[model samples]
Target: MTSLVDLLHHPLRWRITQLLIGRSLTTRELAELLPDVATTTLYRQVGVLVKAGVLMVSDEHQVRGAVERTYTLNAQAGDADNAEVDHDKLRTMFTVFVAGIGGHLDQYLTRATIDPLADGISFRQTALNLSDEEFTEFITAYGELLARYADKPDTADRTRRMLSTLIVPD
Candidate 1:
C-alpha cells in the first residue's frame, strides 16, 4: 500500500494513471497525449509506476527502430477503500495533473497549423443521479467494460484516442 501511495503521490504518475484508466498506451503515445512533458521524463515516471506494481508493461513492439513498451494500469494496486491516502496530497496531485493536460492542449491549439475552430473536437460534461444500489451497479459495469478492452493492441487504423472520465458525486 505504501508503494501504491507513493506511485499516486507523484503528479506525473497520477496523470499517467488517469490517462490509462480505461486504456493502455506506449510511452511514445503517452508523450503525444501529454505534449508538455518530455518523453524521457514520462518514461522515467512510467518506470516508477511499473516498479511499484501500479502499472505493467502489457505489450512491446519495435517502432522506428526503437523498442516501445505499452503499459496498462494495475487494477489491484489502486483501492477506492484505502484510508491511508492523504486527501490534501491527492488534491494537489490532481491539480497538477489537470493543469498539465490543459497546458498541453492550449499550446497545441495555439501553435498547430490545424484550426480547432474548423475541427470538430470538443469537450463536454454531464451529470446524473442514481440510488445507492444503482450507483454500485453502474460502477461495477463500468469497471467490467474498462477491463474488457484494457489489453487490446494499439492500432494505427483505429480512430479512437485516450479520453479522461471523472465521476464525482454532488
Candidate 2:
C-alpha cells in the first residue's frame, strides 16, 4: 500500500480527489464527468484510492447483476498535516505536483481561446520570512480562508479552479 501522497500524485487521481471533495460520486458518474478518461482507468484509480482509505464507499447496491458503489472523500486520509515522510518521497511528490500543474497549464495554453489574466490564472513563487510561530499562524489562517470556499457548489457563474501551494525552508 502507498501513502496518501503517493496515491494522489497522479493526474487522474488528483482530479478524482478534487471532484469528490464536496460530494459523493459513483464511478459511472465520474466517467460521465470526465469524458476524456476511460472508464476502466477511472475505476482502477478509484480502487487505488479506496484501498488507500483516501476514498470511502458511502453507498452501494446491485445494478444489473453488478455491484455499483458511491464514494466519498475520507477527510482524515486526505489530510497530511502531521505525516512524517522521508526526504526522497517528499521530493518525488513535489516533482509530480509541479508536473501536474505544468500539464494543466499546457492544456490551457493550447486551447483556442485563452485569457489567462481574465481567467484569474496565476503562477509565481513567493518567498516568505517568518518564525516558526508566525509560519504556523499563517498556514492556519490561509487554510481557514480556503476552507470557507472549498465546499461551494457549482453555479452558473462559477468555475472550478485549482490552487496549489508549496512551502520550502530557505
Candidate 3:
C-alpha cells in the first residue's frame, strides 16, 4: 500500500479525488467523465487511491462476469492529523493542490463557449483578521455550511461546481 501523500500527489490521482469529492462512482463512469485520459491509466490511479485508503469501495456488483466497484472518498481522507507528514511533503502536497485548481481553470477557459457571469464562476482572495479561536470557529461553521450541499444529487436544475480554499498566515 502506498502512503496517502505518495498516492494523491500525482496530477491525475488528485483529479480523481476531485471527481469523487461528493459522489460515488465506478471506474467506467470516471473514464466517461475524463474521456481524454486512457481508461487503463485511470483505473491504475483508482487502484492506487483504493490501496492508500483515500477511497473506499462503497458498493460492488457483478456485471457481465466482471465486478464493478463504486468508490467514494474516505470520510477521514482529508484529516491531516491522522498522518505524520513531514514539512517538505506538506509543502509539496499544497503545491500540487493549488496546481490542480489552476489546471481546472485552464480547462474551463479553453471551452468554446463560456459566460463567467451566467455560469456563476468567481474567484477572489480576501484577508481576514481573527484570533486563533475565532479562526477555528469560522472554519467549523464554514465546513458545516458546505456539508449541507456537498452530497446533493444531480438534477436538471443543478450544476456541479468546484470550491477550493487556501489559507496563508501573514
Best by lDDT: 3
What's model 3's overall lDDT? Answer: 0.87
Q: For residue 76, give model 2's deviation from the true position in Å.
A: 1.7
Model 1, 1-170: lDDT tens digits are 45465566577777788678667888888998888898889988899889878898899888889988999888887565366548775665566657756745764678548666655456788787899999999989988998787557657965343445677779
Mark the regions of model 2 whose C-alpha exceeds 4 Å error after superposition. 9-11, 59-68, 78-84
Worst 10 contiguous positions by lDDT, candidate 3: 77-86
Considering TM-score, where higher is better, how would the candidates rank from best to worst? Answer: 3, 2, 1
lDDT of 3 by residue, 20-125 (tens): 8788999999998888999989999899888878899999999999999999999887576446778988887888888888878887898899999998889899
Regions of model 1 farther than 4 Å from truth: 1-44, 57-71, 103-111, 115-120, 140-152
| Worst 10 contiguous positions by lDDT, candidate 1 | 157-166
Q: Residue by residue across 1-170, what tens digits does model 2's lDDT show?
A: 57777777788998887677678999999998778999889999999989888899999999999999999999789466336677877887787778777766866787799898999999789899899999999999999999999879878898878787888898
**Model 1 lDDT, full chain set:** 0.74
Q: Name the runs in model 3 displaced over 4 angstroms.
A: 78-83
> Candidate 2 at residue 141, lDDT?
99
